[model samples]
Target chain A: MALKLYYDLMSQPSRSLYILLKYANCNFESKLLALRKGEHFGEEFTAINRLQKVPVIDHNGFVLTESVAIIKYLSRENLIPDSIYPKASKQAARVEEFLEWHHAGLRLHCAMFFRVKFLIPSIVGQPEEPKNIDGYLRRMEAALKEFDTKWLGRGNNFITGNTVTVADLFAACEVEQPKMAGYNPCEKFENINVWLKKVRDHFNPYYDEAHEVLNKIGKNKFKMASKV
Target chain B: MALKLYYDLMSQPSRSLYILLKYANCNFESKLLALRKGEHFGEEFTAINRLQKVPVIDHNGFVLTESVAIIKYLSRENLIPDSIYPKASKQAARVEEFLEWHHAGLRLHCAMFFRVKFLIPSIVGQPEEPKNIDGYLRRMEAALKEFDTKWLGRGNNFITGNTVTVADLFAACEVEQPKMAGYNPCEKFENINVWLKKVRDHFNPYYDEAHEVLNKIGKNKFKMASKV
Candidate 1:
C-alpha cells in the first residue's frame, strides 16, 4: 500500500513534492486538495488533516502534515541525503535553522508571491496591490542579499553548502517567482541567480516535470486544469 | 567552547530554547539579544544571524538558526533522549511532522498573542487593547478546540505519542501563554491542559527555567526600551 499525498499544484511546496516524487519514482497516490475551491477545509479532508492545511500525507496507518516535513520524510525514505543535513553536529543544526527560518523567511516570500499575483483576485476578492507586494519583495530581496553575503559561500551548490539539500530546492523554486511577478530576479540579487542556475542544472530533470506543473498554475490550458 | 545563544527572554522561541538548554544541561554560552533595544537588527547581530532572529546557536564556526533545528542538534549531541528520535524511520519522521506543523498552526496563537498584547503597545503605542487580545484569544480557542477534538488520544503525553518529543516542549512552552495572558486553558479543551501538565511534570526543570526568564518580560525595570 502506497502512502497518499494530499496536495495542490497551485501550492509551491506541493509542486516541490510533485517534482521530488517524479525524480524518486515513488508511487505514492496523489490526491489533489484544491485550496481555490476550499477543499482543504471540508469535513472529509479535515479528517485527514485536522489542521486543514495542504500537502498532507498518509503512510500506512500513520498520517502527517506540513510540506517541509513531508519533503524531508520523502528525502530520507528515498536517496536524497544526510549531506543536506549537517556532517558535523553543528552543521545539522544549521540545516534545521534554515528550515525553521525558511518558514518565517523564505516561505513568506512564496505566500506573498501568490497572494499578490493570484490570491487577492481569486480568493480574497481584492485588487492586486503593489505596495503590499513591494513590502514582501523588499523582504525577499533582503533574504537573497543575505543568501549571497552570508549563507552562500564562494563556491557552493546548495543553500547550506553544495550537494543539493531541500533548502536549495526550496529556495530555487521560490526565487523563480520574482521574474514571473515582473520583478527581475537577476537584477535584484546576482548570486541568487547563480545559485538558482546551479540548482536547476543539477535538479533540472526534476524541474522539467515541475516547470510544467508550475506553468499550469496561472495558465489553465496545461495539464492541471484538465486533470485533478 | 560552549555554544553561545543570543536571545531575549521575552521571545516565544528564545524562551523555548532557554528551557530546553536548561533541562538538557548543554554547554552553551548564553547571550541576551534584547528585542526591546532592536539589537536583533544591528549589523553585528545580523552577521551572526542574517535573519536577525533569536534562538541561534553559534557552535564553533557554524551558526545555526531556528529553535527546532537547535533542539535536534542537542538531541543528536545526546543532550536529550535518542528514544525521542527513535531508531524506527517512520516514527522519527512523525516527530519532524509535528515540529513542522508546530509553526504553522500552534504559532498562530503566539502571533495573535504578540500582536495583541505586545505589538499594539510596543509598536502602535496603544494602551490595553482588549479588542486586539480578544481576537487572538478567539483564534487560539478555535485551534485548541480542534486540537482537543482531533489530536489527543486519551492521555497521550506528547503531541506525537507517549514520550516527550521536541514537539511536546514547543507546544508546552507556547501553551503556557494562557497563564500570562489570563486566558482559560480548561474553558474549552481538556487535552491541551493534560498535555501541558504531562510535559510540565517530565520537563519541569526546563519549564521552570523558561518561566523564570519569561516572567521578566514586559516589566519596565530591565533596560526595557527600544533603540530601533
Candidate 2:
C-alpha cells in the first residue's frame, strides 16, 4: 500500500508537506481536505486524525500528524536526502531550532492575521476587525524582523545556513500566507524577501503546484500583489 | 569545552532543557538567568540569543536556543541516548509530533494561563483579570482533554507507546507550570493525572531540583492545591 497524505493546499503546513513529498517524488496517495467545507470534521477523516488537522500521513498502517514530524519521518525513511533535515548533529539542530521558534513566532502571528483578516470575513461571514488585524499585523512584522535579523542572520542564504532545508519550506508557506490577505512580506523585510525568492527557485514546480489555490486567490482577490 | 546552558528554571522550556541535561547526566555548565529581573534584556545575554529567550545552549561556542531544538540537538550529538528520542524513524516521528503539537496546543494555553493568572499579577504588579483567566482556563481545559484522549491513548504507558521519550520531559515542564499558580491538572483530567505521575517518577531528583523555584512559589504564595 502506498503512503497516504491528507492535505489542503490552502493550509500553510499542508502546502509544505505536499511540496516536500512531491519534490522528493515519494510514492504517496493524495487526500484532498477542504477546510472551508468542514470536510476534516467528518467521521472518516477524524478517525485517521482525531485532531482533524491536515498534512497527516499513514505509511503501512503507521499514522502520523504534524507537518514537521511528517517531513522528518519521511527524511528518516530515506524518502528524501538527509541534507533536507541534515544528519550532521549541529546542522540538524539548527534546522530544529528554526522549526521550534517558527511555531510560537511566525506561524502563530501569520495564522492569527489570516484568521482575522481573511478567514473570518471571507469564510465565516464575520466582520473584519481593524483593531484586531492591526495588532496581529504588528506582531507579524516583529516576527518577520526576528526571522530576517536573528534566524536568517547576517549574510546567510537560508535560515540555518547556505543550504535550503525543510525549515525554509515551512517558513515559505507560513510567511507567504499573509500575502494573500494584502500584507506584503518582502516589502517589510529585505532578507526574507531575497531568501523567499531563492526558496521558490529551489522548490520550483512542486512549490507552484502546491500553492495553486493560494495563487488563484491571490490573482483574483489580492491582485497578485504578494508575488514580490 | 563543556556545553554552557543559559536557563531560568521558572520558565517552562528552560526547565525542560535543564531537566533533560541533568537527567542525561551530560557534561554541561549552567548559566542561570533571572527572568523576573529582566536580566535577559541585558546586552551580555542578548548577544548569545537576540530573541533573549532562556533554555539556550552553547556547545563549544555553537549557541542554540529553543528547548525542543536543544533537546533534539543533544540527542543528535549523542550527549543523550537514543531511547530518549528513539533512533527508529517512525517512533521518532511520533515523538516529534507530540513536541510540535505541544508548542501550539498545551504550551501556549498554559503559558497564557500562567501569565494572566500569576505572572502579570506578581511581576508587573497588575490585578488579575478573572475574565481573561476564565477564557484561558476554558481553552486550557479543552487542550488538556484533547491531550488526554488523543495523545495519551487508552493504554499506552507513555505518549508514543511504552517507552518514555523527550516529549514527556518537555510536557512535564509546561503542564506543571500552572500548578504553581494553583491550577489542578490531575483533578480535571484523569489520564493526564496518571501520565504526569509516571513522568515525575521518571525524572525524580532532577525534576525536583529543576522545579525548586516553582516549588518554592507554590509552597509560599499559591497554597499548592495542585498536588495529585
Candidate 3:
C-alpha cells in the first residue's frame, strides 16, 4: 500500500496533516516542497496536483487534495484511529462541524493575517502597508474571539471534546501561523493558550517535529525584528 | 427519527441541503428563517443556534451546523443515497475535494460578489462603491474560471464525475447566487452553464423549489436595473 504525502511544513494545513499522519503511525513517504522557493509551481508537482497546493496525498495512485478531505479519507480507510477521528455518527459530526466552519472562519483569517503581515512582505522584499496588516489582524482577532468563545468556550478540554481530535490539530496548526508574524494569540486568549498547549503536548515530538521549520523561521523573524 | 432543518432558502448552502433532503426523500421538518427579517437574531432562534446561521439541523436532539458536515452526517446515517454522496473511498474523496476547495474558492468569491453588488446595497438602501463591486467581481470571475477549467473542464458531465453529486449541488447553488447581482455565468462559461442545467434537471422540482425565493429576488433585481 504505497502511500505518499506531499507537504510543506510552513503551510498550516500541511503541518496539520503531517502531524496527523505521524500520530496515526501511518507509513508514508514524505515529499516536502519549499513554498518559499516556488517548488509547488514546478511541472512535476503540478502534474500531481494541478491546483499546485500542498498537503496532497497519493495512496497507491489514488491522489487526493484538501487536508480536511484527506484526513477523513484516511480515517475511513482506518489508517487513522477512530479515537483521533471518531466513527460514531454524532461524534464524527462534531469534528466535521468544526472542520467545515474553520475553512471560512479560523483558517481563512489566520492564513490571511500570516500572509499579509509576514509572508508577502518577506517574499516581496518589503513590508506590507500598515493598513493592510491591521485589517487582516482585526479579522484574525475576531475569528480568534469566536474560536475562543464558541468552540473552546464550551468548557471542554478541546474544540470538539475533552480528547484531542483532528479538529484540535487543524485549529492548533492554524493558530500557530500568526506567530511567524510575531502575533501571539496565547497572550490575548486564555482558553486558546491553554488548549493550544494541551494539543501540542498531546502530539508532541510529532507536532513539534512538523513545526520545526516554521518555529525556526518564527524565531528568526522575532530575532530580526528585535534587532531592528 | 425527528429531523429538523433550520435554513433560509436564500442562503446557498441552505438551498443545497434543502434540495438534497428533498431529493433523498427524507422526512424532515423545515424551520425556515427569513434572513433579511433579522429573524436569525431573535432570542428564540439564538437558543437553537447561537451562531445564528441557517443550514443547521437537529436530528433527534443532536444539533449540527455547516451544510457540508450536515450532508455527510446524513449520508453516514443512510439518509442520503450513496449515488448522491458516494460510499466508495476514492469517489467520496473526489466529491469532498471540490467541497473543501469551494469553501474559499467559488463560495467565497461568489458570495462576496453577491453581497458587494446586490445584498449590501439593498440592505444599506444605497449603491456600493463601483470599485468594491469591480474588485469582488474580478475575484469571482477568477474563481469561476478555475471552477470551469479545473473542476468541470475534465470533459466530465459533473464536478466529480458523470453523475450529479453533492459537490455539484453546492457548486450549482453558489453559481446561481451571482445572478441576483445580474452576473450571468452562463454567458461567460459554457461548461458551468451546461453543468448547472444538468444538476438542476436531475434534482428538478426540489432544486427549482429551493431556488424560488432567490430566483424571485433575482428577477426583481433585473427588472429594477432595466428600469434604471
TM-score of chain A of each: 0.80, 0.94, 0.97
TM-score of 2: 0.94
List each candidate's DockQ score. Answer: 0.53, 0.84, 0.88
Which of the two, 1 or 2, has more TM-score? Answer: 2
Per-residue lDDT over A69-163 for candidate 2, one digit per residue giving the tens place of the 0 to 100 score: 88778877888778787878888888888898899889999888877888888976775777767888898888889888887757779887799
Q: RMSD, model 2, all Cα superposed?
A: 2.9
Off by over 4 Å in 2: A223-228, B224-228
Which digits, one per residue and each the tens of the lDDT, describe model 1 over residues A77-143?
Answer: 6534455533466665556666777776666665676567656655666657767567776777776
B-chain TM-score of model 3: 0.97
lDDT (CA) per prediction: 0.68, 0.86, 0.92
Could you tell me how far off, in angstroms, the CA of residue A158 lies in candidate 2 after the best superposition? Answer: 1.4
Model 2 residue pairs with clashes: none
Interface RMSD of each: 2.3, 0.9, 0.6
Q: What is the lDDT of residue A110 in candidate 3?
A: 96
When summed lDDT is taken over every stretch of 10 residues in candidate 1 chain A, the lowest stretch is: A216-225
For residues B48-118, what per-residue lDDT tens digits would candidate 2 score against the true structure? 88899897899998998888888777877788889888877877888999999999888998888888888
C-alpha DockQ for predicted model 2: 0.84
